[model samples]
Target: MKNIFFILLSLVFTSITYAHEGGHGTPTKNWSFVNNNETIKADFIMKVGDMVYLSNENNEVLTFNYSEFKEQDQNYISEKANFINNLNFTKESHRLKTFDYSILLLLTGILVFVFSLFSWKTKPKKYFVTYNLFSASLIMMGCANTKSSKVLKMAANDIPFLESVFGVFNKVNTRHDDQYFYVESDGIPEHEMMTGITNWQQQVPVDHDYSGNNAWAIPLQPELAENTLSTKENFMKGAIAIAVNGIPIFNPLNNRGEDANVIGELDKWGGHCGRADDYHYHLPPTHLQTKVGEDRPIAFALDGFAVYGETTEELDENLGRFTSDSTYQYHAVKKYPYLIAAMKGKVELNPRTQAPENEIMPQAKTRGVRPDLRPLRGAEIIDFENPEPHQYSLSYTVNSQIHKINYGWDTDGNYNFEFVNPDGTTEKSHYKRN
Candidate 1:
């Protein structure tokens, strides 16, 4: 009786040892090879370093250096190696290991029954249930631990900040692949068009497909150009930047090399419909602050720089500056070159219409020109004198000739104007305030 009890105890410990060392089988696939001019089949284990491990039909393990294979076989194994490297082994092994726990619990129950036959001085029934439950709990913990590692790895690759920023724009869809960050839209503004335009008769806003072949994408990482291109002459044409609302912003200067604002072409929103029926902005859309907030970016340049509505710090001539985090950005100004006066980053040069020599008029050399008024089409303020409240005398150049105009409220609140030409002739006009 004593000998039999010792034998059973030794077997129980040995079974538990094997259970921990030998896990459930891993996934295997059939592998074929030619031996002695005969095709041989075996179960493939895995590629370990530079060698492939296999198990023959009789369960004999075999190892072969990858270089020992024929050229054709080497190519086949190389492709399979890539597949095995990227496989999600953590989850797959967890499932198989959990199934092993069931088998372990069953063997533990049998061991308890055999031990009970040898000695029953203690409560055998109570111990049997307790051991089985503990074994099952361990399997659950193993599976949870394995899945958590994969979840954490995926989280590390997510870019949440970019996802949140792009979510703010309407009709804006963004995606990323290996090379570029793509932004797709129909190039339409969310705000009302053709509103508050004095010259809407000449141009009406129209809908454009602006989809498919017109879809725009920017490089995932922006690289600076050797030298920034100036927005002067005919450098900037077509779409230089894209507003968050999906509209394309062109150069502030219209096709004729004239300011769209003074030409009475752009609406109060600083945008107008192009010849392609594409509505776009010539100046910064300052009114966007009411909708998109002053602190947020209003647009993105083709070079992948964010265009903010306003910035407190002084910026370069291009209305661009580096942020606190050293990120380059362009902001809108309240002057002639309102948005960008030049491409602040790298850009592909597109063709632009040449300005005729007659269209490029010279500035006035005889007077002090206002920096703010010089770019206004056919108009420039030379001097201004205010003699009283709401009364002023002004000298301005229009159509390349200087003119003097004096206007104030008469006793009856009627405004009167006296216009003096450069040749010394005067014209008088009056208007009654309603």
Candidate 2:
């Protein structure tokens, strides 16, 4: 019975020594008076200036002015705020966690005294006493100077790191203001386009001026959203991310609510021409991994989260994981919503637009000189050729017959088009650039 009792006591001590390692407990206190003679129970998260953030019993995060609380609670909040301000959290290395050494020493002395008394009373064997002391020593040493789970949030993204990712492609240029890092390029990739598209629309790829006041903007400091916005029915109107090669990546689904890549609408590089003749990816261009390396980010979502190529870590529903204690980022997968399943960071949606077709503001805009065209049924785009300088031809086959659209432009902004019929007949049209 004595041996059993000692074993149980050691087990309890083992738990006590490590209980404070992972995290500290939060107490629910009456932070503010919601009504007369009634109060709201919330755990104080932290205080940022005058704002005191709290989590209610329902786990809902709430905020309020410190003055709104009772006098005693207000005093506690001020003391907490002052302690938080004095702590050095400027860098991850500086954020430290500590356990009271005095408490540990007190516990150690108590354990030794108890062991001595137990040995004297029970008259245990020499081997048992030695084993008990050794076991206790191991536990004490393990808890000595242990690091806790408290961590600091990452600082704002560095501009140089952003520059290096976009710099590998000569066609893309980058600049930054206080809040946003902007990228500019003519919206056409150096690789092939329009080939391997079985469900081709008659629209051809056009080079857009994705420069000047219309460049893509990525926030310098990303803020986590209170609730993540899912992508299934939202964000269908604008680009969700911008590729390192200066191309925009849209949602995996087309505006018609269909998987564009699986429907044979996308080319070999996972890109297709939109109704406005604008070329963009309906999925992540994972092929760019060869150029940017698999470890580095190949793109940045409009929500300002980095999009990495391949990862072995299990990702969350947002198609992302915390790369560090506080830095979270998205990764490319081989399934639907491959890049970002949702906007993991806070972004301002254009208020005028409604859900499923709403878009993030401060994004680049696109324009087309021609009207929207219907999809050419039974058409398969097999080849895109630049027959000569500034002149190009795109060929497609419908029912085993081939047709081509021969188009080109001049320095004066004048455009010309010749549509060659499969029956050896031809029709021509001309329009000047607006």
Candidate 3:
């Protein structure tokens, strides 16, 4: 009975110690002190020897001896002081589970176990037990830590994948609250903008902060709607999704229901400047594959589905399909309604084709016409290519004849465009860089 009791007691103590190391306690909040007819509310900042430091609303610091408060209040202060002291020690204990320290210990134990397995035939029974025990102990300790639970929860939230895909935009500050994933950006693309366009409406991509605190918030876990909305004539919205780099992606079709790519408004990267001076994509950001990876998600749709690279396999009418595990996702394609043919998941739509009176082109507006940039009327895209950085070639068909255009900045920083007609005649236009 005595041995059994000792074992149980040790287990309880071990669990308590592990919990303390993993930050187990409710943080103390600001408290109010009642002294006769007066009440003073302040945060219990710190304790120095017998004095307690407190801060008020106006950032005024006040110090008082332990005995200055009433007996009950004095007891409460003593209890809080003890907790803070214990928290300091607990912080030191948690250092064992820090990323660097934990990785080192885990790797060392794994290497020992691996070596032991290779020499198992000749190794002593005690050596095998010791090596295996060491590795197992590290894993068990890691599992006992709440940090491991946090890591697991983050994985469940799909944070690792987001970090990998959206890391390039970290400078713009990306974060998540309980319900929404917030991203703040200047709405500018790192890639070159508006290279081969003859009529440049808003040539410069301006900065717009859509961090979602007051503007846009993407649902963390999007719920699928019973009735999915199709991407059709009436459903055309300004931006259906946002790229990881913070630039919004509009519908492939313009307000007139014509393909934006065919209309020759987008640059070589399938993006152009908006009326609000915002740079965004109207087609699949295929050029981003070299940066974000071909297999990984290139953009996240408003419906909360990730948009991946195109595949030869056929998808549903919405340009979306499910993963092997039945996780629904959208993919970019070469055809019309490229990024998303329709919203597969649930989303709130305004149903109005025009922006609200007070609207300022939000980063994730569900329904509104993209800024009307009139494409060279009657021109249909034949082909668009980017042979090198800052260089672009566009082919279009007008009046039953094919025409070619090559446009970019020359080595001397001169903006130049060469237009060739089917008759083998060429026209050149030049502009100075601002």
For lDDT, the strongest prediction is 2
lDDT of each: 0.57, 0.78, 0.64
Q: Over the stretch 1-434, how does candidate 2's per-residue lDDT look in tens digits?
A: 56865764775576466544533345457754433466777787766435577777666667777677878888888887677555533323432323454346446746765776667656667645554555565455435434342233545777999999899999999999999999999788878788999987788877777988999998998877745666776888889899988899999988877888888999999999888778999878888888988888888988888888868886665778877646788998886767788788888999998888888887798887577788889999989998765677999999989999999777776668899999889998876657
Q: In candidate 2, which residue ranges exceed 4 Å CA deviation?
A: 1-154
Positional deviation of residue 171's Cα in model 1 after best superposition, in angstroms:
2.6
lDDT of 3 by residue, 1-434 (tens): 45644554565456447645423234334444554555577667666445677766665567776666777777878888799777765764565456565566557667877987986889787667665665565554444553533421111237656666788655456777676676667565676666665444423443455655544455677666544554543345567777877777777766656677775677778887666556788887877788877888888877677888898765665777777744677888776667677677777665444432111133453211224344465565556666765566767666778887776655554656688889999998776533
Worst 10 residues of 1 by lDDT: 360-369
Colliding pairs, model 3? none
The window of 10 residues in a row where model 2 has the poorest summed lDDT is 88-97
How many pairs of residues collide in model 1?
Answer: 0
Which pairs, if any, clash in model 1?
none
lDDT of 1 at 22: 24
Estimated TM-score for each candidate: 0.43, 0.65, 0.47
Query: lDDT tens digits, residues 42-155, model 1?
Result: 665555435666666666667777776666766877777677665634545755665566556555556655665455456675454444334344333344333323311111
